[model samples]
Each structure stands twice: as structure tokens, then as C-alpha cells.
Target: MNNSRLISLLGISTLRAAPRDVHLLYLSRFLRTAAFGSTGVILAVFLSGLGHSDVRVGLFMTLTLVGDVFLSLVLTNWADHFGRRRTTILGCSLMITSGLVFAIASNYWILLAAAVLGVISPSGNEIGPFRAVEEGMLACLSANYDMSDIFAWHIVAGTLGVSFGTFSTGWITAIFQKPVGWTEQESYRVIFIVYTIIGIIKLLVALKLSNASEVSRPTVERQQDAEQEEAQPMLQSEETSVAKGPGPTALMRAVRIFVPELTAPTRSILWKLCLLFAIDSFASGMVAFTLLSFYLHSRFQAPMSLLSSLLAIPFIFSAASSLLASPISKRLGLLPTMALTHLPSAILLGFLPLAPTIELACVLLILRAALSTMDQGPRAVFLSQVVRPEERTKVMGVVNTIKTLSQSAGPTVTGSMAQAGNFGAVFVIGGVLKAGYDLALVGLWLSRRALAEHDDIVLPNVNDNLAENEGESDGTSRV
Candidate 1:
């Protein structure tokens, strides 16, 4: 009886596991991220190595943001219609094939063409469906576990990928014991092979998943109600259970762009968030492109191998920061915690130019990494709180696409300045601008309540209400 009781307890614990999908997603993302981290930070440096000018590198970088923006705006709704699993498989296939094609690209134009084909430019949206599917799956996995902890696990996995990828790149480049024809740049091409292999693994994992395996809210109720709706046909001797294509015409095209309107409260919050994001991102963009690679290259004259190792330091700090984020949020509150972290981050970023020794620069960068990233998890929570559930995917896509655009522009402008011999000034300018953004955020908080209590607001549809003066709502849930 005692042994049976212990077995039962173990089963319960497994059922209430903190992140049920950790194994499901961790390896796939690690593979994708490893290849991505190895190249993106140092792409401009690689381009410089190939004798391309900074402007050309900047344009190459800009193409990534352009793709993200285009895809998010145009294709996001298609995911809503086609089902997220199918969308994810398609997206991942594109991602995997693009990386392999990229390995063989011979020249700058070929590389640019590879980027276009791969959609490797820069896109969270490309990967967004995977998260949607996983999160929906996790909801079915456990009723008792806190969603926050699960998200934390997701972040932990992502950081591991980044740190591991960067570290491996540096290590391999540092000790290429084989007398192969692999140049430092060629090592990046090899990383793509890793990405393709992982993509295939994830594709296999995808096959094991079922659309109906995950339970959504009020699952039985929704199914019953949907069946009821389909039971009766009112017009033209036929009943349509699903919304059909809006039809193919110029008028339909115009209607598609204009029909889905964001609510007023959501619109207001979105604009403020966008303004804040744009300001913060411009600074972040500049830092993102130049910070690690340029500092290592210009100040320390570090090679690709050492550069990879040095890049690991920041991601390591980021992983630590994410681990401690819950306790930090509990102590500081969300917005204040974010502001406090950024103050130091901006200061450290500005101090980069002043570091007299390579050691000092690394120390400052690590410090900046720890503080700057503490906000990421909490910020995601805040986003969920501010938007309705049905609209969450579309809203997130729009906001993330904008953020990507701002980040994409940062590298281009900063690369130009660095090439013009004004790198120091750019750091100072970025820091001050970010500091101003921090101040603006603080002001926004001062005007509002100390903390926002989550509220679920559902609006009644006009047509549905007309059927009965008794109003009905598709339910919404919030904490």
C-alpha cells in the first residue's frame, strides 16, 4: 500500500509538471537558435570580411526586417484560417530549406537572394505559430501549473540555445583541429547543417501532435454550441458551418484590409506601446548590431573564435536574469522593475566607449545584459493582460513586427556611423535616447494606477444581439 501511494504521488507530480512541453520544443529551438545566433550578431563583420561596405551590410540587414513586416501584415490572418499546425509545418520547412540553400550562396547578391528565399531576415512571426501551438498544447497538459513558470522555461530554453550556439561557434573556430578548407566564414555555413537537421527532428515531433489533442477553454461547451449552430439552415436550402473565403475581387480585397477593426481601448494602448517600443528599439537596434562584434573586433582585435566566446557572456547573464525575474517582479512590481533595470542598462551601454581595458568592457556588457533582459518576461505578461484573448495573436504579430522593424533599422544607421568613424558618439547617443524612453515610461506609470488588475471585457456582436434583446457574449477570461 505504501509503495502504491508513492507511485500515485509521482504520477500527480508528473501531471503537474512545471513545463510539460519543455522536451517538445527545447531541442528544436536550440537547433534553430544555435545557427541563428552564430551568424546574426556577426553578419556585418562577415560582410566586412568579404570587403562589402557598411552601407551594403546595412541594406542586407534591413531586408530581414522588411520580410518580417511583410509576412506579419499579409500572412498572419492566413494562419488563423488554415490552422496553426499546418502553418507551423510550412514555416519551419521554409526556415530549414532556406538555411541549407544559404550554405551554397557564392557572392553578396547570392547571399541576399538566399536571405529572401529563407525569410531568415528577421521574424518572430515566422516562429509565432509554433508558440501558439505549444502554448495551446500546454494548456491541455496541466490545469494546476502556473503559466508564468511554463513561459520562464520557454525563455530558459531559448537562452540555452543562444549561449550554446555562440559558445560552440567560438570553440569550433578556435580549435579547428582538422586541416579542412573551412575558413572562419565557412564555419557559419556548417551551422546551417545543424539547423536543417534540427528542423527535420522538429518536423518529426510535429507529426506526433494532433490539432484536437489540446483542449481550449470551455472545450465541451464550444463543441456543443458549434454543433447547435450547424443544426438549422435558414436560407437557400443550404447551411454553411464555416466562414468561406471572402471571395476574390478588388472590393473583397479592400474590405479585407478595412473590416477587422481594433477596439478603442486596445488601439490607445497599442499606440502608446508602439511609441515606447520605437523609442526604446531605436537605441536597442543600434546596440544590437554593433555592441558585441564591433567592440570585440575594434577594441580587442578578437578573431571570430574569441568573438563567439565573448558573445556567450551576455547570453549567460541573460539566462541568469530570466531565472531571477519572478522574484524580482514580486519585489519591484512590473513597470518599476523594468524601469530600474533599464537605467543601469543605458548607463552601462554608454560606458562601453569609455572602457579602458577589454576586461572592463566585458564586465560592463555582462552587467548591461543582466539588467536589460530582466524586463522581457514581465513585458510579455503585461501584453497578455492588455489584450483580449481572441485578438491576442493578431495583436502580438502587429506589435512584434513593428519592434522588429525598429530593431532592423538600428544596425543599418549605426553601421554607417561606425564606418564614418563616429562609433563612440553613437553609443552615447543611443544611451541618452534610451534613458529618455525610460523617463517617458515612468511618466506613463505615474498617470495610471500603481498596478493594473486584469479585467476580461467581451463586447456583444450587433447581429447576434438583434436576434434577441437579451445580449450574449463569447466569453473572455483574465486574472
Candidate 2:
């Protein structure tokens, strides 16, 4: 009984209740994000070391994201039809291939082509459909579990992965450059080689997933049924034009497939979420770790060891802070929790550039990290609770799609500013913009609070829900 309580406190009982495949998915994400952590730390400076200008580096980041947006859509749209496990393997394969090319290729065009054609993370976060597919698989494989715990631990795993990846790359590169006397390019290439090895391991993990991870016939049938049901009203409507009366033309059918079938009210809220998240993402992109690391390298001439170690500090905060998301949201409600925690982070980000020393800057960054990701688990849980189960994935996908689109422009703009010798302004503007977004989100929540609804649920009965969930998934083995 004591062990049972301890396990529950730790999280989706840290996968105690999860199926073997769910555990595999978490492992896959950890390895993949760690690889992202490795490359994201060096992506910008590596390009600059290759003699590319800041503008070129920024443009490269932007174009890579632009390509990724399309790649994500195509692969995710076909993920189920193509097979989830197979799709996962394909992502890993791309990771390996991309790493190998980045490790060896020097020509800017060749590197760009490799980045666009395969999996390369510009922001050191996920840039592909791997997240969505894996989340879906997790949902299916662990149908009875409380995803809040699962996702909380999920964020922890990814952040920890980043922490490891960044620390490893920083020290490894520093060792190669200072001790072994390697060139900057050589050290960076070694990091990519390490990334490739991780990718290979991730592929092996993906292969271990059972057939249960694939989309079932019932799920496919339900989707098709939902699609047809959604179109029925449109087809029957007098306003919707068809090739003929009542019947939807092939073109109309094709176009409608891209639309989500949600209630009008949910659609309105989701749109609001899209705008909020898109703005936040844009602000975030402007100060991406890749760019920030580059800034430190250029401005302070900080060693790779310092950059990696200092940057890794925040991921530690982020990982620890992620554990607090579920509990905080349960108390403050999702919107309040998101807005309150994020506002401080944004304020800290704004002040980051004002720091006269690297030590001070790291202090602000560490503080920001403590609050920045506390929203991730809650935001995901918000999506799950705000809409029907069927709508959850689609809504999350839509928000991510818009957020990525908005973020794609940020690096280029920031690069341009850096090239123009206005690097500090980037953070100021991003911080201001992010703060405004948080205020606007809070306003939205307050406006909805006049009447009792989901927002008010936290005030009255959130603890009850938390207790219920705890009782339901105790994770204790029975005798």
C-alpha cells in the first residue's frame, strides 16, 4: 500500500500502468529529443563557423521550418493509412539520414537540401509528426490511464533529454576543440555523428513496438464515419455549392477533408487558442536556443562548454517545473495557470538581454525555464478536456499548425536584426509580445468567468477530480 501511494505520486506512475509500447514511445521521444538537444545547441554557430553570414543562418532556419510544415502535414495526414509504427520508423530513418548528411556535408545548398528533405530540428523541439503520432499511439495503448500524468512525465522526459543532449554536446565539443585541438566544424560534426547514433537507436526502439500501436480498423472506420457525418450538413445546405444539387463534388469532398468537424462553439474557442499559441510561438522562435547560443558565441565568445552547461541549466528547471503543471492547473485552472506562470517567464525573457554579464543572463534564463514549460502539460490537458475525445487530436494539430506557421518567420527576422547589430532588441520585443499574449489570454479567461463553466470547475471541484483520478489509477499491484 505504501509503495502504491509512492508510485502514484511519481506520475503516469512513470509508466507503471502504461503498456510496454507506451514505455517504448516515451523512450523514442527521449532519444529523439536528446538528439534535438544535441544539434539545436550548435546549429547556428556551426553554420556561422562554415563562413555563412547570420542572415543566411536565419534564412536557413526559416526555410527549414517552412519545408517541415508541409512535411508534417503530408506524413501526419497519411500516418494512419501508412501505418503508425512504419511512419515512426520513417521519421527515425529521416533523423539518421539528416544527421549523417549534416555531419559530412559542407556546401550550404547541400546542407539546406538535407535539412529540408529529412528531420533536422532548428529550435531543438519537435519539428515533425513524430509527436502527434506517438501521442495518438499512447492514447490508444493506454486507454485507461490518466493522460495528465502520462503527459506530465512526457514533458519531463523530453526536457531531461534536452538537458542530457545539450550538456553532452557542450562538453564533448569543448573537449574536442580545446584538448584534441579540433576545428569548430570538426567538433560540430562529431555532435551530428552522435545524433546519428541516437537516431539509429531510436529506430531500433520503434521496431520493438507491437502491432497494437497501429491504427485499428475501428478507429479508421470511426474517422470515416465522422468525416461523412460532418459533410452531410454541408452537402444538404443550400449555401454550399456542389457540382450539382445536394451531392458534394470530388473537389468539394477533397477540400472538406482538410476541415475539422467541431461544434461551432468549440471552433470559436479553438480559433482563440490558435491565435494565442501562434503569437507565443512567434515570440519564442525569436529567441530560440540555437540563436541564443549563437549570440553567446559571437558576443561573449563563450566556449562551447559554457554555452552548453549554462543552457542546460534551464532544461533542468523546465523538467522539474513540468511536474508542477498538473497540480497547479488543478488549483488555478488551465488558463489562469498558463497565463500566470507564463507571464513571469516572459518578464524574465525581456530582462534577459538587459543582463550585463553571462552569469546574470543565465540567472534570468533559469528563472524563465522554471515557468515556461509548466503550461505544456496543462495546455495539452486543456485541449483534451475542452473538446470531445475525437476532436482533441484535430484541435491540437490545428493549434500546432498555426503556431509553427507563425514561428517560421521569427528566426529570419531575428537573424536580420542580429545582422543589423540590434540583437538585444529581439528579446525586448519578443518579451513584450509574449507578455501581451498572456494578458490577452487572461482576459479571455476572465470574460468567460462571469458565468460558471469549465473555468469555474477548478474553483469548486478540481480537487475532487484529482482525487478521483488518483483512486482510479493507483498503479498498485494486487496480491
Q: Candidate 2: which stretches are off by over 4 Å?
A: 1-14, 232-266, 451-479
Question: How high is the CA lDDT of each candidate model?
Answer: 0.58, 0.78
lDDT (Cα, tens digit) per residue for candidate 2, span 1-479: 59876566657475776788877887888899999999999999999889999899999998888777766665666667678888888988988999999999999999999898888999988787688777666545544666667778778888999889999998899889989999888989999999999999999999999987775665555666866776676554555554355456565656534554555546767787888898998998898889988887777888888889999999999999998886677668777888999999998898877888888888899999999998887676666555433444455556666777788899999999999999989999999999999999898788767544643433222222222212232211110
For model 1, the stretches where C-alpha displacement exceeds 4 angstroms are 1-19, 121-144, 175-178, 210-261, 289-291, 450-479
Worst 10 residues of 1 by lDDT: 461-470
Clashing pairs in 2: 11-14
For candidate 2, report its TM-score.
0.88
lDDT of candidate 1 at residue 202, scale 0 to 100:
69
